[model samples]
Target: MATQLIELVDGPLDTGKPSKPKFRTVRKDGQIVKLRIVDADSPNFSADLTASFQANIRRARKENREIEDDS
Candidate 1:
């Protein structure tokens, strides 16, 4: 029922102030699912993912090729 309305509008139908992301409800695996903003054609599941590790080696290489002595 709700899915049809969403599809007809190609997105949320709400037009309230302070526009924000919209989420809809659906049934998946016998459980209710909240469907948020997502592009089925161009998936972006990693848009909010952070880097695995810092680029320590890259930073070191860019700092200086020669070693400094403080003795």
Candidate 2:
């Protein structure tokens, strides 16, 4: 399943804040999955996001079980 990331229409929430939920979407296994990313990639340093983002992702996955939720 090739993943297709949906670029956020609006970038990360509030500048300079690293521990906030940012909306992001990706296509996994031919389905689009929405997420709240709290992690940031690095180019120079390695001390980036923690493991807390997983919880949010897990919850999103659980809440959004169907391919489409018209609610």
Total clashing pairs for each candidate: 0, 0
lDDT digits (tens) for residues 11-53 of candidate 2:
6443332444456899999999876554445431122243345
What does each candidate score in C-alpha RMSD?
18.5, 16.2
lDDT of 1 by residue, 7-55 (tens): 3556644433322334679999999976554333433323311111123
Top lDDT prediction, candidate number? 2
Task: List TM-scores for all candidates, in order.
Answer: 0.25, 0.28
Clashing pairs in 2: none
Q: How far is candidate 1 from the true structure (C-alpha RMSD, Å)?
A: 18.5
The prediction achieving the highest TM-score against the true structure is 2
- The 10-residue segment of model 2 with minimum total lDDT is 42-51
